[model samples]
Each structure stands twice: as C-alpha cells, then as structure tokens.
Target: LHLPAPTDPLLRALHDILRTDPADNRSLDDHGRRIGASARTLSRRLRDDLGLTYPQWRTQIRLHHALILLADGTPVTTVAHHCGWSSASTFIDVFRRTFGHTPGTRPTT
Candidate 1:
C-alpha cells in the first residue's frame, strides 16, 4: 500500500500510529509529546493530512463504536458511556446528526 513519506520525525511517529486500526484508543496529546511535537502541530497535521481535526476524528471513532453497540442490542445508556459521551441525550443528538436517525428510531433490529 502506498503511503506518504512524512516530512518530519514528529509526523512520521504519528503516521505510524495513524496506520494502526483507529478503533484502538489513542490520545493525540500524548502522542504529540512523545514525538516532540505540540498538540497544535498534531491537530494541524490531522486536519491537513486527513481533513479532520483530532477531536472530530476521535468523535467519529466514538460514533462508530456507538453504532456497533446499538446494533448489538446494547442499551443506549451503556452505549453512551462506553462511547465516551457525556450523556445519552448528547449521544443521541450526535447520533441523529451523523446517521439521520435517533438510536431508538432506527429500523435495524
């Protein structure tokens, strides 16, 4: 698979982490410091390279986790907690915005 050769050591380190399955929990702040880059640098790279900010990417990851939980008959409360939402209502709002339907209103079994 072709991948961009990173321009800096900091970015190269982050690129390796990015290569891993994103579902694996990773903290951008910690990764940034480990590679001698600031959190802002990491955020910029995430947006410039991946077209998303770190938080946005993380939120998307959590939302995907929520979908899996919901599909597997997990309770909405459990899903929200596990997916890192502050509350079920917030999770449902994001869920609806992203998927165009609320969790309880989905057609899936």
Candidate 2:
C-alpha cells in the first residue's frame, strides 16, 4: 500500500488511534463519525491518502501489532485476541499469508 504521509487532520487522527490502540476494531462508520465525515467520504479520503480501504488498512496495522507481540514471545492465542482477530485460526491464516509462515514458526528471542 502506497500510503501518503499523515498530513491531513483526519489521517493524522486515524494514525494516532491506530498507533495507540491497534486493538481498536471500529468500523468505517464509527471512525468516520470520530473524524466528522460520512463513511463514503471517509472511504474516498482513505483511498486517496493511504491507497487502501479502511478494512485493508486496519488489517495491515493489526498485523504489524501482531508481529511485535509475536517477537516479544507472546502466545499466538493471546496475540490473536489482542489484535482483535476472531479466532486463532483466522489470525494464523492472516499471519501466514502476510509473513509466508505460521505463527508457530516465529523465532524465539
């Protein structure tokens, strides 16, 4: 995803929310409300600014958090829960797709 820098107020706010709380699984509607935009407008702005839809962007950010948790020796189940995955299986599937390996293959530090 070719994301633009967080220059817009809405983008900056969204970045802050994602950075401070990757566990936040708010829908596009909820996020738009926080930024004073309709979901449609929010979608356009996100695509224009970030080159991805809300859900796609959220997944990317959540996976980033998942990686950090995994690197810190957190259990996969706990990491899945913390990252707001519906189930460990789902989390593993996403992790595998993104990283080309299952969470169990993560190197212990």
Candidate 3:
C-alpha cells in the first residue's frame, strides 16, 4: 500500500513530529510516548491510516532532510548524523539506493 493522500490528517501530524526533529532516532515506543499514543496504537494508526510502518515512514523523512542538508553544503558525515543514521557508511548506502547517487556526489548549492 502507498502512503496516505497528502490531505490526510494522520500524515500532517506525523509530518509535524518529523519536522520538529528530523534526526530523531528514537524507538517506536518513544515516538508513541511523545505523541501520547501507545506504541501499538501508533503502529496501527500508521498502518491503517497511512499505509506505512514506522521505520518505512521515518526513512523517507530522514532521506528528504538528508538531501536538503547536502544541498545546503552540510558535510556528509554531519548530514548522516542530522538524519539519524547510525553511521556515515550506512547513510551513504541508503542515500545511493534512494537517490541513485551517493550523498557525496550531490553538487552543493
């Protein structure tokens, strides 16, 4: 299944949380607590309302921010950290997979 339509309220709330802390590397339970929802409820809501699992959605959020940071001339290592990646290598791998190029290859704006 795909993500919820852009107009979905659930997507808005999730976007708010993500934008506030794009580097948030917290567990699903921690995210649930921050939003005043139980982990199970958050999981269910994401699945039912947004057609996404927590990690899947978070990865998309992180990658989007990574691109922005890279374009703005943030160091690739710093972008990795800012995007909540455990390591720069992992970040490079995911960035390459998602964007078809390594983060280092992106021309800075």
- lDDT (C-alpha, whole model) for all candidates: 0.71, 0.81, 0.77
Tens digit of lDDT per residue, candidate 2, span 1-109?
2334555678778877886788888887888799788889878888887788888888887888887888899999999999888899999998888777799895455
Off by over 4 Å in 2: 1-5, 106-109
Best by TM-score: 2
For all predicted structures, in order, the TM-scores are 0.68, 0.86, 0.80
Q: State in Å the error of residue 22, model 2.
A: 1.7
C-alpha displacement of 45 in model 3, angstroms?
1.4
| Residue-by-residue lDDT tens digits, candidate 1, 1-109 | 1224446566667656654434445587787767788899878876677677666766766776677778899999888878777789988998888778888885575
Query: Top model by lDDT, which number?
Result: 2
Error of 3 at 49 (Å): 2.4
For candidate 1, what is the TM-score? 0.68
Residue 33 of model 2 has an lDDT of: 90
Query: What is the C-alpha local distance difference test score of candidate 3?
Result: 0.77
- How well does candidate 1 match the true structure, expressed as C-alpha RMSD? 5.7
All candidates in order of lDDT, best leading: 2, 3, 1
Give each model's clash number: 0, 0, 0
